[model samples]
Target: MDSKLNRSVIDISICSRSISDQNSSETGKESHEKKFLDKNFTTKRHLKSRHIQLIAIGGSIGTGLFVTIATGLIKGGAAGLLIATVFWTCVMLLLTSAVGEMVVQYPAPSPFVEMAGRCIDEAVECAAGWNFFLMEALYIPFEITAVSSIIDFWRDDYSAAIPISIIIALYTAINVFNVKYFGESEFWLSIGKLILCVGLLFFTLITMCGGNPAHDAFGFRYFKIDPFGSGYVTTGGLGKFEGWLGALFQANFFVVGPEYISMIANEAHYPVRKNLSTCFKTVIWRLCLFYIGGALSVGILIAYNNPTLVAANTAGESSAAASPYVIAMENLNIKVLPDIVNAIILLSALSAGNSYFFCSSRQLYSLSKRGFAPAFFQICTSSGVPIFCILVVIAFACLSFMELGTGGSLTALTYITSICTKSQMLNYLYMGVTYIAFYHACKAQGIDKSTYAYRSWFQPYSAYIVTFFLLVLCGVQGYTVFLPGWWSVEDFIFYYIMIFVNVAIYIFWKVIKRTPFRKSSEVDLVSGLKEIEEYEYEHFKIAEEAQINSDTDSEDYKKKNAKEIFNNVKTWIF
Candidate 1:
């Protein structure tokens, strides 16, 4: 056994001769002696900032923006929009900052999940991973149902089964290919959605100003009729307030993908810190243009209380051709343009479904790699894609088609999507807590400040604010479930069932495995300390050059030389 091990090491050295020569050339030192290496690990960095940025944009622009916000608009009137926008802005600030700080530190695959394990506790990691997996998986059916409804706009009498099948098949094909291909497809789809949104914004502005190119301007006559009346424009209780809250939540839901960018940290090139920072910066404009623009356009042109808008909201058919955008376009007499917009909605939904597939599969893949899931799911194809995990995702997505076949299709679809949102809210709250712990862990360890790429300002305060608001939203959602005669107790039961299921899973796994909670210091410090050595070694030449330029005396040079000498010695030892 010892001989075999020695032979393996010798062969690996022969194969990595180039790396050894390069290291020796830079330091002008003999490096024939081989260092120990981890036999089970591999580094594969393939993502670019463009991919990260577009993925962020794609995360924010989806069927929820084009359709679901109508429910909120119908409920809260304009105030709902104000509340949602404010809530979302605050949540994003906390999430973006928390996630941004973590990614810069460790820069790994499935960042949030790993951080949850290392920073908070292993059980928290399990909760977060499964929550993300279940939430994203739940969206598959909602997206399919939504696309099927959108397709029915033109067919009138068409059955949803045909469209649902076609959408499932297309989405599966895209995800099964490869990550780069998946990204390329997402980029183009994002472009199409961006163009469509920009066009809608400009067209709505023109119509409101009474410049119909062929008719008298509608002006703001509709606004004066009743700014908060019965439908999309109302400002009452469940009628207006609920409607706007619905829209606000739906808009925020569409933009949830920005955090998923953290999952790709291991695949990103360049300085992981700088690239992660660049990736997060992409969220600001995406929210501004997609969510804000889409909501405002719906509010201004379509009477807030339009009959069709009310019907869709009450029926939860925001997925249908009766969406706020469609209602507004049809009111303008734009010929076949409403149908065109409906087609765009279907395309966008399909895009979102593709993303859900990718995220869910990758989440499972990450879990498997960490021993939390079955080893079979860790298998990656030659392209570095997790083929087995992707197949499992597609299988679950196909199950979502049941919504189209059921009598309660609309409600079922909305419930499933709502569950997805609820699960994510739970994950966000956990992330906030984990981030706070991670910051303090560094301080306790006396880790050098300069080594950290980015620091989350406001510390525990920012995290606390985010966690508090999330709990409030959860409370609001729960309250709505039992609003006297306004809501059914069954709604509350179903919503809480999903949360209970996640907790149940965590508790069951903990007891069955008899796993004890590891202290923060005992936690695997992948980003906290282990990588510091790797980074210094990788950038040794640069550090050497920097030190040489900092001082001119031979003694200072000797001191710098001693530092590098010690680093090299430490690298060779433990």
Candidate 2:
């Protein structure tokens, strides 16, 4: 009994001393989390609701929608393309809904990566951080190279280097500056992209109804081409199935969902809960209206076997001139509009690269702040820029210069697209995994998800379904290389490199760090919850104080509330 008391006393004494020496106390399990949230004080919150919504909209409308889309139709045929898009977009919606469930609760910067570490394992976190960083950073050059393709459609006189240098310079200027400027620029860029999407859909409707010079009422004439188009590697029904699978692969690169949307959380203005909730809720329609609708319109505009599209593919051309929609416009004898479309496509690519640059840097920042990377990456500038992280990403962005070689960047764009697709696929797969673990964590901790401010339809089941499909896609994503005569060693490498790399990362970290597979019961939900709660309460108190003082701020508040409601309704319906 005396020995036991002595041991207890010694433990108490140590605890008292450790508490006094806060630095020593921080070396426990929560060490990484101790200063993890100090970034809240460092990062500026300037992105308003409109900025975030537009940014979210812009993230989905990348160069893929405008440039690489015809590649989908080329491989999958029109029907296969439409069906593939529908399949992936639906899966993405469900997966993002799972991500939304957590983002609503945390609202930290790049908090999805944090969720993986907290709910699953830190090793997974390390893998997620680096892999996600790879995808986002690489997306930068991919877009620039896409811009190279689009710009080349009009001119081959200039070396790609000059334009690439200009674009890189512009990207550097935008990202190194304040995020508010970035938000505003993206808002306008996204506005242009939205107009382009709607305009093209309208163009499809008008032209298909005999509104053009030809007055050809080609109502789903393309649908007669087996509705699924010809197959990639073979002929007949199996080939059509291959075509559909190929379209699925193409669509995989195009649809990066909630993960992209959640990147702005740390830099968004007050009332993050409402802002992120609106962002997630709107993703449903964003996918449908933009991607699925685009697919439908493209299927109507041009048959997969049109001579122009066939010849463009035969010649290995992937410029704006080769876009199915642009080809349709040219076929209809529409003169100036195709140029306009190309212009907007160029802007769309630029916006996407810019957004990716911003998100990737923040992702790196999230890693370092969480102790998964070097501490220097955690340093933020007065403007809330992660300078070191941004520099690293900018350095990667220089990969665009590789396309400046004898051949154009179009070929490089294809390979980069494949890599980015695999990275995104792994991200989606883990997002579902992280959500399931988070679901269990919520249950294990006695937290009521039913009372969440934002709850997506379908429970853990959606996660299960998405994860299974993603796994199948990841496994077979490189199957085309195995097809007879379709073999290319380079294609195989770019296609499946991310999968191998992601596994290697997880294994290496697990072995070296000895990071335990954290059980759901041991997840750290409370670590960041208090900060978010404090943020929300501080916001609430300001309003309460205004009301108590009988300031006109109360009336302003009501007006703002009414405007917010109207905006929410408009956003949902649109």
Q: Highest lDDT among the candidates is held by which one? A: 2
Candidate 1: misplaced stretches above 4 Å?
A: 1-44, 156-159, 213-248, 318-320, 408-414, 448-451, 486-489, 514-523, 527-574
TM-scores, in order shown? 0.80, 0.88
Per-residue lDDT tens digits of candidate 1, residues 1-574? 9857755655565547658867766785333223222222233455555666666566556787778767656655544564576568657766777777787677766787788878766777787788888888877877877777676676748666777788778877777665777777776776667777777888878888876645757665655544444543233454555555565566556556345677667666554567677666555545666566666666677676788787767765645466776777666666777777777777788777777877788888888877788987777754567777878887777766676555676456556666777787777777777777776776667666555566665776888887787777765655555555557655776557667877887887777776666565665655433343344334454567786677666787778779868854532221
Q: What overall lDDT goes with each candidate model? A: 0.67, 0.82
Error of 2 at 518 (Å): 1.4
Please report how far candidate 1 places residue 531 from its true position, in Å: 6.7
Measured by TM-score, the strongest candidate is 2
Please provide, for model 2 over 1-574, each residue's C-alpha lDDT reduced to its tens digit, 9 standing for 90 to 100: 9857755665565556557768654555365444533343366788888888888888878877775777788788788899999999999889888899898888887888889999999999999889998899888887887788789878889888888899888888888878898998898898889989989999998998899998899989987776887676889989889889888888887766887678898887877788888878876676677899888888888888888888886775657887888898988899999999999988999899989988999899888888888988877766777788888988988988888655556566557755887898888888888999999998899997776778967887888999899888888988878878889888888888888898899999999989998888889987876566556655666777867766455777679778979977655543
Query: What's model 2's lDDT at 405?
Result: 59
